[model samples]
Target: MTQLVLHTHRQEHILRLTMNQPENLNSLGFKLVAALRASLQEATRDDAIRVLILTGTGKGFCAGADLKTMNHPYAPGEPDVLDCIVELFDELRNFPKPVIAAVNGITAAGGMELMMCCDLIYAARSARIGDAHCNYGIVPGGGGAAILPRLLPAAIAKYLLFTGELLPADKLQHYGLVNAVLDDDQLLDHATTVASVIAQKSPIGLRRTKQVANEALDKSAADAIIHERLAARDQFRSYDYREGINAFLEKRKPEFKGY
Candidate 1:
């Protein structure tokens, strides 16, 4: 049976996830979505991993779901099509480790939702992006409607969804969808540098901060501040946290075992 291909690599505290379907521009599909969910679960369980960076191999970050595969017979109790997409998005968004999307090429439709799930997004200067569901005569059934507004301004998100038009990488960088844009030749190098910076930080601190940030995204300012203070209070009491604080005071680099 055909399956989604993925590549994994771990270097100390960093976990790199690479979509390995350059042949089809890393299109998402039933099997691919399932595989991604399993992979993220495994990543969360590994104490050694402090950061998770996602990218695609070859020329395409992801081209959204595989249109050709939609013809297959569905299971009797399959998940709601929209729910299935949100599951993947949620997995990435709520990951304990920092999640970064290295958008190296085309990202369209569901692919845009996947990219938006990451906390930080680094796009290749040549990448093209969009939500093209309306062009197919169906509204976007993925989490883009809910996720896009969280990532960008309401007017821009609506414009993109309504028109189903492709936006250039530079344009998205200007629009704030992309955090960093580098020349295609420097894309992987730049993304790796960002991942390394995350990996070098205290694992416990990074995880707590990421969790707090997610929790605060939708909360009132006062509640969010309280949530952050409580999370920090709990996290800073950990053994590794104490060590990190001491290391900072001593003017030395932290050596975190992800405790």
Candidate 2:
């Protein structure tokens, strides 16, 4: 089976991207990284795709980078692991649509970084997530260092980074990072519902809102206001904007064509 599985629910306009290498805990090896990148590119190009739900199969979400791949000597034709990681981080950060993380079991090290980058994270109550880079006598080669501090409190981030310990999903949820802590069986269904609700909205509005929200933290309040105004103005020009207004006035649900 492929390392990555991209299943498109065309009717819902949702794409479920599963990391399929469960035997290796869906490690971020060259194959998995390449497959994920290609899948994201496909999602980007497909207009019908509105929301992306990222999850993994079997026992673990991802066990960070494949030690086997990293330990092996590099060959002339091979892509650098660092390069692949950076590319994946960039793709996740700039993915136009909302990306929801349905985190299952054993999310650690770089896997935790990947989950943190998503717009929303819904975790299974039984899942364990943390930064375990220290355990291997190495630090994060990915964006973990940069992103974790931003997501978590200084003490919490330092504790995880320094100790390399896994924390239960409930603990993370208590920190207000995870959107929901759910039963294993309910994880996917809840994520799908969120995606379906978002998918029904105007695509341009969602994209613009996401763009602004993602960058808001980095911008000044005045700058964010200006940015949001510009985004709202652009949204007004979209066909769906008019459709939404008309539908509201007519007391009917808007059928967004993603224009």
Candidate 3:
């Protein structure tokens, strides 16, 4: 992939999507946003890609929206930068494959929102997170408002959004925003390791599992259970399920055929 803004690399069914524009602290500008959207959509259509990894090059992951673009002339709903972020959130949330966020440094405001969109997030111990939008006379137009409350306690979400204070990765991990925290140098390694395991799973199983989980997040327990039962029964009849069970009985790794 060209390094204009986003770089996508695929190996063994794992796609690592790196945010370019390291010189700009990986800010999401128009070109960068467009590049990312295109690359993600391309990966989405590839049936071989079972796992998606989101990270950034250089010292920082993403600082926020491009300050320069903030002043550019624009028309009504003419594909604003926030639109790009919303698109990304939708992609990650709806992706048939599992999406993991690997954050190495500060990821405030929109960056944090992007991180939150991932199915799982791993961060460097020193990485930071915050809703810096309040400091800029704005609010999170991304999925921040909707997701933070789900990831964290309602009171905790209120304090963070209200104060907009930056918190270290450890704190966020305790708050459930981050799945885990590793050494700065091991951030991507941990992310890739987890993604690799996910990539080895049956694609049909993984996709249905992700969809069911995402859909059940806001559903009642009984409703979620009903959906889960239906999903499990449907997937159990697929060829992959038979392979999985036979492989288990034979004590061999199953060769999943994405069915």
Candidate 4:
């Protein structure tokens, strides 16, 4: 049987995970979700991996949950689809390393939600993105409904949610949802170039920065400041922090140990 997810080490510190069920547009089937979750767990524990890139093979980044299995009867004690989706997304959202979503093609509904979980989103010019749940009379079980509004303006979010219309990546970039839109042929190269830069930074600094930033979203302004201050103080105690400062003074590159 073919692998549900393909794992490639783009560099020593960069991992690219490609959803491989192109025949079904890489839909989030049970096996695919399990594979992705397992990959994420392994990446999280591997200190050498400092960045992750998520994409898909063939014509779709992801078409969302496997529709054919949506209403099927479950086997005894089988995991609920929504439960699995929630777990996978939660892992993505809280992943310590930076994740870049290279949206190469059609990304709809939960596919878009998965992209949103990444730290950065770079889409191909031909990539179509939207909350397509409405097209199938399905309510979004992912962040399409809740977190999307926070990511984009309320009106724009509502339009995607209500219409189920797919928008070009450039259009979403105009709304500040996508970090950049590149030509189809340039998407992966651009994503890897960006990830390579991030990989050179202090790993602990990036992890702490991500932690503080994600937490700040749910915090009040004053509380966010305090949280950031505490996080910074903690980070200052790390070896990478001192190495960074000394490296600058000595005009040499910092050798970060990811401590």
Number of the top-ranking candidate, with TM-score as the measure: 4
* lDDT (C-alpha, whole model) for all candidates: 0.83, 0.88, 0.84, 0.92
Q: After superposing candidate 1 on the true structure, give the runs of residues whose Cα lies further than 4 Å from its correct spot.
A: 1-4, 80-82
The superposed Cα distance between candidate 1 and the true structure at residue 151, in angstroms, equals 2.0
Off by over 4 Å in 4: 1-4, 75-77
- Give one digit per residue, the lDDT tens place, for model 2 in 1-259: 4323333344459998888887888888887888888889999999989999999988888889887777678789877787787789789989999999999899999899889879999999889999899999878877678778888898998999999999999998898879999999999999999999999999889999999999999999999999999999998989999999999999999999877
lDDT by residue (tens digit), candidate 4, 6-101: 656557789999988888888888888888999999999999999999999999999899888788798889877877998999999999999999
Q: lDDT of candidate 4 vs native? A: 0.92
Which residue runs does candidate 2 get wrong by more than 4 Å? 1-11, 75-78
True lDDT of residue 108, candidate 4: 92
The better-scoring model by lDDT among 1 and 3 is 3
How many backbone clashes does every candidate have? 0, 0, 0, 0
The residue-level lDDT of candidate 4 at 150 comes to 96
lDDT at residue 88 of model 4 (Cα atoms): 98
True lDDT of residue 202, candidate 4: 92
Q: In candidate 2, residue 227 scores what lDDT? A: 100
**What RMSD, rounded to one decimal, does every model reach?**
2.0, 1.8, 1.8, 1.2
- Model 3 stretches with alpha carbons more than 4 Å out: 1-3
On lDDT, the stronger of 3 and 4 is 4
